[model samples]
Target chain A: MGLIQREIERAGIATIGISIVREFTEKVQPPRTVFLRWPFGHPLGEPGNSAQQRAVVLEALRALYQIEEPGTIIDLPFRWRREKYADYLPPTAADLE
Target chain B: MDVTRFKNRTLARLATRFPRLAQRFIDGYQAQESAGSIPWAVPKPLRQAKLALVTTSGIHHQRQAPFDMNDSDGDPSYRTLNGEELFDDFQITHDYYDHTDARKDPNIIFPLGPLRELVSEGLLGRLAQTHYAFMGHIDGRHIPTLVEKTAREVAAKLKADQVDLVLLTPA
Candidate 1:
């Protein structure tokens, strides 16, 4: 996704991207990005939350304005899933591997 | 298959909700998506620029052919959608993500309503003639082709439509 965003940016059209995975997006940065710690499918916020979605859209566009340099990623303060992220995270160095 | 070791219900639910992520974590591996270098494009004001959005949520017109889920490396194809299309004319076909909510409310994946409202409020530049969608699961050797070929194709389409800014929403 970041690759395609970079290609579009190279084509001379400024591009902004929203990513579910910040680590992955941070590696292959688009010209501008908004990193949201959200679910896989809902990039603009949860389903049916139009106001929050619109706010997200505004923030995404606002990211374009605030970022003067390329490859800048603005992390949105929003978060989803009240579960302990560490609990859901698979053990990196454990019996699983 | 073993739930005895995990105590958190949310964690167990997440494993079931997105099996791909769970599998990757179990394997202790994830894709290294790196373009190596950043590409810069001068941006115009949001108020008057021609804005466009591209989603990887498998949204396409009802008349168009759906994405090829049979491809192991996933589909690199993209479909064009205009603002004028009815909400009923679109559907999702990607197998990777959970689309139950998206199916219930397409705005979860595609923000046509919010975008149109932005236009109505004059909060953004005019929308371009077309928006785009591609299945998000494309990987393996097809990655480069998608980056090179399909990206150019979409960029050409955007250029022809005089789009100045593009917003990419990845599912």
Candidate 2:
């Protein structure tokens, strides 16, 4: 996945990837990434949990803009099965700008 | 006797259930070392940039050909996905991970559901009509094929579509 992201970013479109395994992301080093220490097949969090999923998507998009250095991987703070989505602060337009 | 498939599935289940076990598998598998300047492109603001999703969760339309599970090296090919129609009929075909949860709700791995919600809320500008999916688990001889051929092809497609940014997910 990181290899693919590299190719896409090389084509001049910004890219951000969500990585379940930190080691793999570290090795491949795509342009930008957000690492989740969660299980495989659940990068955005639990099934049917829209709030949790949205929180992740928001953070990943934020990473796409915030990361100035290539190959930077931001470690996300959300914990599996323990996060409170109600308190999760998404990036507002002002924040992103 | 599909011993290899059975073995891979068993390992997947075990790894999914046990993170410690998953770590061992991660340690054993090595990604090719990448050296050199990483790629870069200035991103447009979230509310104005055209975005797309790319995933390696082995997802595809129900009618598309399933990725090959017989090869241990894994499938290097990709499937074109239509964001507007994907959730209506989609399936996952990777054997390297237990996709039971993803099957229940693909947003966990694909996040198209959330991405659409963002577009509706105006946090994102728009989604490209086309997205992409790969089976991942590609290794050995197939890595070159993924990096050199299929991935670049998808990149070119994204470029042609004028996507400003892409969000990638992995299984």
For TM-score, the strongest prediction is: 2
Inter-residue clash pairs, candidate 2: none
lDDT of each: 0.74, 0.91
lDDT of 2 by residue, B53-78 (tens): 89999999999999999988999999
- lDDT string for model 1 (A1-97, tens) is 7877887888899888988777767767778899877766778767777767776777777777778788888888776644332323221111111
TM-scores of chain A in all candidate models? 0.79, 0.96
What candidate 2 gets wrong by more than 4 Å, as runs, is none
Report the poorest 10 consecutive residues by lDDT, candidate 2 chain B: B110-119
Cα misplacement distance, residue A29 of candidate 1 (Å): 1.9
**lDDT score, residue A35, model 1?**
89
Kindly state the fnat score of candidate 2.
Answer: 0.92
For model 1, the superposed segments whose C-alpha errors exceed 4 Å read A81-97, B1-32
What is candidate 2's TM-score against the reference? 0.98
Cα deviation in Å at residue A87, candidate 2?
Answer: 0.9
